[model samples]
Target: MNRILRVKEISELLGLSKSTIWRMRRDGLFPAPLKIGPRAVGWRESDVTDWIKSRDRLQ
Candidate 1:
């Protein structure tokens, strides 16, 4: 099963600020969050992992 990650978790995992993550999403450089609730959003673990791998390749 795929795990859902919260903004704090994602921020720590990527070593980026929440604002940066939001900016990346706006720029289409990051994975979009899943709407988990009326006022909540989360990212799929697999999607984040894949994104990290792809970024690693670009370096």
Candidate 2:
């Protein structure tokens, strides 16, 4: 089964600040997070992994 990760977890995994991710989402520079609920947002494990790979290719 696929996993989902909250902002804090994603931040830690990426070694980036939560706010930095939030801003990237706002500016449309990163893969947008999923709206899992009315009051909750998260990133799918696949999506996050894909984003990381895409970024890696750019470097």
Candidate 3:
């Protein structure tokens, strides 16, 4: 199963602030997070990795 990364982890991985990540998500510039629980959400590891790869390609 794919790992689900919470906001903190994603922020660290992307070297971005949590708010920045949220803004990117809201602006449709980042991958949408999955609803993992009643009040929690996370992004799929694969999805995040793919987003990184796509960014690399764009550079």
Best by lDDT: 3
What global local distance difference test value does model 3 have?
Answer: 0.97
> How do the predictions measure up, each by TM-score?
0.96, 0.91, 0.97
Q: What is the C-alpha RMSD of each candidate to the true structure, in Å?
A: 0.5, 0.8, 0.5
Which of candidates 1 and 2 reaches a greater lDDT?
Answer: 1
lDDT of each: 0.96, 0.90, 0.97
- lDDT value for candidate 2? 0.90
Ten consecutive residues with minimal summed lDDT in candidate 3?
6-15
lDDT of 3 by residue, 1-59 (tens): 99999999998998999999999999999999999899999999999999999999999
Tens digits of lDDT, candidate 1, 1-59: 99999989999988999999999999999999999999999999999999999999999
As for candidate 2, its clashing pairs are none
lDDT of 2 at 24: 93
Candidate 3: Cα lDDT at 3:
99
| Segments of candidate 2 deviating more than 4 angstroms | none
